[model samples]
Target: MTSVWVGERVRLRAKEPDDWEAFHSFEEDSDAVRNGWRLHPPSSAAYAKKRTAEEAEQRPDLDDPDLVIATRDGNVPVGSIGAHHSDRDHGTFAYGISVGTPYHRKGYASEAIVLLLRYMFFERRFQKAEAWVYSSNDASLALHRRLGFVEEGRRRRSHYANGRYDDEVLFGMTIEEFTALHT
Candidate 1:
């Protein structure tokens, strides 16, 4: 498998349909299911085929890119990262570590994001990358902050989740800033 970006403990690679079961497992996990706005309940398989087809047809040229994170040990995919162009020269991303219940808090998310940002800035030549975080997801907000994604904007009551209105925080990082930070 080709590596997208290699880091200390993990590498990013292209997602394959063979990963469907694993991806589904992660998405179905209790925490993941609750946090993922668009992801339905674990037992629902309604859109699996369609989602797989969509991801399979995605072209890397104009964003809508997705990558899987695999640990160095056995190359098992632990998480996923994805980005799409919101507009020319500007892009937005959503990422999550579905590293199974056993692998949480093991730095997989951080590694996946670091590789994803490197690819977005250096490979795809994007000007900026942004992520949307739900207001209550403190772990994700903290992760974004650590990665230099500053809080650029927020939409109050933008999303309705868990029977409540939730705020959405937008975090962004520029190509220049990413390069400088890495260097």
Candidate 2:
């Protein structure tokens, strides 16, 4: 069996088709596209397949990062995480994660982020990790800060969401910074 990323409360492993079945959009307050976290939900299975293919084209040297977060006890599908735009030459990557509505506040997302980062940094030998989140996304902002991602920059009023423009914040962490946090 392939190795899985196990954390205190969650496990990061291969995404099953069931995971896609359980996949859903965020709450009204957290509409991913408007918040600038994603472009749109896959329209259909065919579209999802095509999207995956295109993503593979962009990341020729790498396979898809299909890490799904599930409860360690029952292995119930809760969310998905991906490390995209990976630069093996530079040992850097950008990542995004999505959690199902039913899975919120169960610490699934929190543990998944930790496990994914650990796998990327230690297992994959990555040096730096980055993510973009809207400044209005208090949950994400707080999570990134708590996880040691520093604010690298910001683009004010760059994204239009919820009938108004919201600022996009860039957060990043280096291997050194990650080590300082975990060690």
Candidate 3:
């Protein structure tokens, strides 16, 4: 598949050597990590340098593609959305929006997710797509529901984060379901 994709308000491309700064900024946002799960906290400057090298050595995910989506005015990356796979035809996706430190309430995540789903179902030929949202994440739950993903199951008390074992909501949408809805 091509490394670059564009949507109405955003673009998905390959992660480039020049995106080290943006990648570092994303890694440093503790609030962003807190809402979602992040395996590690990264220092901005060091991560930027390391990310450039990492991109060279690793395969691209939906978000990590040499991709950037801007407002068409300034061409800045507001956030990221992409997938990673353990094997062919099965992959998990991560998506979010972070224009600045204070731009959380905006609808970037929704827009990005809509486009990501379209790409996954139509372009990637994925049979199904799955998303795991922290149980307390009402906004995420609502968003997935709106996008036609069914709440298939949950892993109760599955994660021990922030001093609690929170449940994880499992949501999935098959390509057939998505196609039928759109048609």
Candidate 4:
């Protein structure tokens, strides 16, 4: 039987000690970092390796730990996805996703999202999912729209990037909507 974490082209897996290379490579991609989340100073390869090990060890304690997005065939690391700001009392959560530059538009990110959403809605019992997108990140904005997430609202000029401020667009979807569309 197919596993819940397994999707058409990608599978969600726990972070490994050896995943440092992929993680570090992602940090080097300025566009990926800026679009996916706020930019920060570059990190050293040694730091990335240490951070991956530490995070892997602490995964069990996290309510929703980050998962590596790997190709189904060779299990090659392509990106990462994770749920955050989970409010168990309110049955709501938000997630962030980042796919490596070379792997863009290959459907890996979409399938990884579907896998995560299914697990969150069905297994974790989260009623709603939300995503925050930067106005400058055209790819993420389009991806969310294509996945059926409604444009809930926008926090204007809240995110500063590239020496300019950009609006943060909020997108949301309920379990009912997810079921109707995905099931």
Number of clashing pairs per prediction, in order:
0, 0, 10, 0
Per-residue lDDT tens digits of candidate 3, residues 1-183? 433255455555445566667656666666456557644754667657776767656765533233344443355656555564423535444334334344454665665666666776666565677778878767677878987889989999887666777788888877787778753
Show where candidate 3 strays beyond 4 Å. Answer: 1-4, 56-73, 86-101
- Per-model TM values vs. the true structure: 0.80, 0.79, 0.74, 0.95
Clashing pairs in 2: none
lDDT of 2 by residue, 1-183 (tens): 535478767787665544444553333325644543545534676655554445434522332376667788889877778889888899999888877666666778777877777778888899999998988888888988988889999999888756777888999999889889875
Full-model lDDT, candidate 2: 0.73
Give candidate 2's error at residue 109 in angstroms. Answer: 1.8
lDDT of each: 0.70, 0.73, 0.61, 0.89
Candidate 1 segments exceeding 4 Å error? 1-4, 43-62, 89-101
Ranking by TM-score: 4, 1, 2, 3
**In model 4, what lDDT does residue 71 have?**
95
Candidate 2, residue 129: the lDDT equals 91
On lDDT, the candidate that comes out on top is 4
- lDDT per residue as tens, model 1, 143-182: 8898787899999998876677778998888878777776
Q: Which window of 10 residues has the lowest lDDT sum in candidate 2?
A: 55-64
Which residue pairs in candidate 1 have backbone atoms (N, alpha carbon, C) closer than 3 angstroms, thus clashing? none
